[model samples]
Target: MQTFHLDAISQDRQTLAEPYHEFLRTRDMSAGVYHMEPGSHDPQGAHQEDVLFYVIRGAATLRVGDDELEVGAGSIVHVPARVAPRFVAVAEAIDVLVVFAPAESAPTIEVKYTA
Candidate 1:
């Protein structure tokens, strides 16, 4: 069985322009870590596959379509395929574990940056 340690995964210094680190990928699904700084937000978009986000550290206000809620470390958020999702009002730097089923290819729609 394949094994991964979170500490080891976090130690990798690879910087992404999009604030994400893809740590695992398989035929069935893919997993990655996303980091966002305070006051920063994710671009609004939708994925082709169902996606799951597990907050690993910090907190933020997450918006899924017309709904919005506060999410903190240990919270899990799910976004169905082709549903718009975004994060905002970050109180602190946030680290989230992201997973996509059936492996994500690309966004179903064009991404829009949020200010």
Candidate 2:
């Protein structure tokens, strides 16, 4: 059995100086935690694998493609492959649990943020 504690994962990520940390990785999927401080810029670009984000805490405006939507705790968001995704105007520190289909070890598409 595999078990994880979110707090522990978050601590490890912080120790590594990364905003996102992957705790689980398999052939078909990977799960991680992404923490962002208030008013921080998202350093992510488009990925080749589909992604699912579960907002655990805090609030922010998420930009997917040309759409901007408000998101907060308990929100579930999905983004398809090769689409730009970003979190802007963060009002609080966000802790998002992220899932990527088919793992995220493969190459990704880098798209510069225009906004």
List of clashing residue pairs for candidate 2: none
TM-score of 2: 0.90
Backbone clash numbers for all candidates listed: 0, 0
lDDT of each: 0.83, 0.90
**What's the true lDDT of residue 54 in model 2?**
98
lDDT of 1 by residue, 8-49 (tens): 676662444568777889999999888889977587588888
- Candidate 1's displacement at residue 105, Å, is 0.4
Candidate 2 lDDT, 57-106, residue by residue in tens: 99999998889999999999999988878997788999999999979965
